[model samples]
Target: MQSLGLDVLFKGTNFLRLLEGLWVSVRISLISVVISILLGLVAGVLMTSKNIVLKAAFRVYLEIVRIMPQMVLLFIVYFGTTRVFGWNLDAEASAVIVFVFWGVAEMGDLVRGALISIPKIQYESAEALGLTKQQTYLYVILPQTVRRLIPLSINLVTRMIKTTSLVLMIGIVEVLKVGQQIIEANRRTSPNAAFGVFAVVFLLYFLICWPVSRLAGYLEKRWAA
Candidate 1:
């Protein structure tokens, strides 16, 4: 059997470079997720409010995000901003902005659904107990909403991590970008370089995401019980 010479991955600092790139992806996803969750929580709670204008504004934001393809959003932020506004945004910053926009919309909708899923009786019961609106949310409604939101939110986290691959189009040197570089460098000498590098990228993503998915399932089952 002809050896595929997968050793190229381990050659010199190749593996370390991949790790550094993976760190960039992870860092962007993590920070964006944090910001998304906070913003989503607020937008979601506001979505359930009785005020038509407030709800209508957030509804439009949600619709825009849902309708726009993330890649298009990335381009608009990274390239369009530079052309139109001369903003001089870096690739990583543009990636963060796009992902945070996507994440906030998705997470907000998830939160809205979770909050609305609670029966009206729950709210009435809180009122019957003479709980203030804030107290009701703090002590009763939010806890249940959180349990419902957790599993879905974790899934979003995985989605954001995977989607960070799109950042490469704007020249962020994340894992996929690193893999491309490795494959290009070895294109002549190692015919199997693309296969080997992409396989490693697949495994790295699975290694990062699979645990989060499993935890979501466990929590779902536990909450259901």
Candidate 2:
């Protein structure tokens, strides 16, 4: 039995195909992140609303999202919901839906924390200056909230990207799924190829995630400064 060895990941066709899978994962993550950010901002704002009813409703939603494991969320979206509701969501779409739900909950909580962290005195001062409510949020509260939110939200983006790999369980042809396919296909000729293939998959995930992590670190530093 022969194996491609450690070098298989870097070979021509294999490398290109792996990169293609990476791009597909990246695309799904990006779309989910954008949608999540928008939803999170709205939810976060709702969380802080003075109206008791709105706050209570958003609180319940956040609690449910925080309590659920992402894999189970994926399973519910891809399997359970389809069976129960007759909703025929494709795997990729289901993955996006699940991650967006998770990301929004996480991001909303971060935003809530950051918003509440702002000094109460700051609001009083804005009111003292005769600033309108809209002006106060636009010029005062939002800028500061954004600075705090950036690092935390960036971390959430990285998490979402990593979590997208779980979509493979639903038969989405992600990088890990492709690696599984390759390993199974070549296992007959190259016994014990699974470990090598998985190692390559790990590296590919690392390569993709590392830069975003570094960027998150840089943003944290810059925001701190």
Candidate 3:
């Protein structure tokens, strides 16, 4: 029995390999997202801090992260850091580190934007109602900020998933890397395998990212509505 392309996609071992690769991607993305959100929130708040030192520090951090390309960051962490420090770092670990660093900076900027976008009158009204600093943040400011933050954070998640592809450069056997290996292994038997395998890789990424994109859009609309 000849195997069709769909058969390759669904056969037991192939399915397991694909799932394993996907699980690695998901694990990295999920952990990176959590770290990014927590640290980003803190940095974001600091970016808006009244203290000049805090704000300036956060601004510098944001600028550096935003300007540094992810591939260069990965290389620095995985190669330069290890060579300079005499430390060993695996590709997966380095990928997660790079993504979290980038994601945190991006999320912090998004959060800073949201926080600043809040009207000053809202703060005044909170104070007029006898709300203390903590109380205002807890009751008045955070609720509104959360509504604005969710969709933006979803957008960040989508970006992180896509950037995981760059992990291949650092030798992580992610889906794209695995696909490349499969195509290379079959190059002699299937000369056109490169295009076919890469198409599958593209579709896999689209499937992963599209739903998150839709979710972000839906939240924005429902909130706006």
Highest-scoring model, lDDT: 1
lDDT scores of the candidates, listed in order? 0.90, 0.82, 0.82
Per-residue lDDT, model 2, residue 90, is 86
Q: Model 1: which residue pairs collide?
A: none
Q: Residue by residue across 83-162, what tens digits does model 1's lDDT show?
A: 99999998888999998898888888988999999999999999999999999998999899999999999999999999
Q: Which stretches of candidate 1 lie over 4 Å from their true place?
A: none
Locate the minimum summed-lDDT window of 10 residues in model 1.
1-10
Clashes of 2: 0
Candidate 3's displacement at residue 159, Å, is 1.1
TM-score of each: 0.95, 0.89, 0.91
Better of 1 and 2 by lDDT: 1
Clashing pairs in 3: none
lDDT of each residue in 101-217, candidate 3, tens digit only = 898888888888999999999999999999999999889887888789999999899888887878878887788777776766656666676676677778888898899989999
Off by over 4 Å in 2: 1-4, 7-12
- How does candidate 2 score on lDDT? 0.82
Each candidate: how many clashes? 0, 0, 0
Q: Itemize residue pairs with steric clashes in candidate 2.
A: none
Candidate ranking under TM-score, highest first, comes to 1, 3, 2
Q: What TM-score does prediction 3 earn? A: 0.91
The segments of candidate 3 whose C-alpha lies over 4 angstroms from its true place after superposition are 1-12
